[model samples]
Target: MIILAATPIGNLGDASRRLVEALANAEVIAAEDTRTASSLLRALGVDNRPRMIALHEHNEVERAAELVELAREQDVLVLTDAGMPAISDPGFPLVQAAAAADVTVTAIPGPSAVLTALALSGLPTDRFTFEGFVPRKSRVPALSKLAREERTMVFFESPHRIAESLDDMATAFGGDRPAAVCRELTKLHEEIRRGPLAELAEWATGGVRGEIVVVVGGAAAASLDLPTAIAQVLALVEGGARLKEAATEVADATGLGRRELYEGALKERGR
Candidate 1:
């Protein structure tokens, strides 16, 4: 069986009983950083050290097949430095391989920076998307991809790049679009800063530390005339947002209702 476990994002107490048992019993552990995994195990008071292997970005592709092979014979546990494996981490390829090999796969779900940020964001969470992290290079293209994400969107970023990412979001969406920057979630000194993208960008410029999670509100409803709303939606869409997202941005920007703007955009798209 293949077990994908969630490690604590910051607080070690967040580790679950299942995760602890998995660590104790697993024959092999694939970790992004072996030293971090060892430290976590020690902190949890688990004396046994399982055979640990490195499986970060550089070697994930080659390592995945080997890990999958191990899962076919014995229990293999995959973990990252923090949070769940494969969530913007290094476990997806192994999971994919295990699935192809018909291996039984499961998760010992626990702490998540994504969910933690969303819960603290004070934004709409009923419908949300986790984008992991935006691409470092070609940020414009990356922001464009998320332009149409209608659900509240979550992104992981480093402290240094938070300001730049926020600025790009402001440009991709609108300066006034709502967002929240959650730092050091589930840890002491945790902070949640919420407001428009422009304001957040400015606030981040002063300097930031610790882990960063960004939660952005979806585009606003379009209350303007059909043609005007359509134009606004089209502009955002052309600039790299999804159509549904563009409509939301238009609605928010124009103080129009969501349903109306959605319908208008659909009509314009001949949907």
Candidate 2:
């Protein structure tokens, strides 16, 4: 059997009893960081020392087959530095490999930075999307695609990029879009800053420290009428957007027909 254990994101006290027992009995452990896994065992006072092997992003695919084979003989445990495996961390490859080999896989669920940040974000949680980390470059275009996204959006970001990312988000989602920036979650310096995207962008400009999770409210429920949307498209075209690009963007934002918006813009231009 293959067991996937959830590790605490920050506070060690969040470790589950099942997680402790699993660690105590694991025959072979695949960890994102072997040193961190050792520290975790010591922190939890777990006595059993399983043979630990690294299973991080750089080597997971190559090691999955080996780990799965070992699981066939005895229980194999998988863990990340924090939170559940296969989230924004490593473990998916191993899970896929184990599944392909028909090996039994189970999970010991516990602490989660994703859930923790979302819960504290103050945004509507019923409908939300976890986007993981924002793309380093091309982030603007990436966010543009989500300009019409109705569900609240969650993202992980580095401290250095927080300000610029929030600025880009404001540009894509609108400055008035409500958002929250969660920093160092579950840690001693945990901070949750909530406001409009513009405000958050300005705040992050001073720089931030520690791990970060950004949660932004979705686009407004109300959509613009077709005529209003067409006018907006034309304005964008006048501002240098290609006719198709402007029409598509406005149509997406207003839930209008792209073809109709394009036709309307062209007709207005002809007039």
TM-score of every model versus the real structure? 0.82, 0.86
- For candidate 2, what is the TM-score? 0.86
Q: Which candidate is the best by TM-score?
A: 2
Clashes of 2: 0
Task: Note the Cα lDDT for every prediction shown.
Answer: 0.83, 0.87
- Candidate 1 runs further than 4 Å off: 223-271
User: Model 1, range 31-146, lDDT digits (tens) per residue?
Assistant: 89999989988899887879999999999999888888888888888889999899899988888988998888899999989999999999998999888786687575456455
RMSD of each: 6.4, 4.4
Q: Where does candidate 2 stray beyond 4 Å?
A: 224-246, 256-271
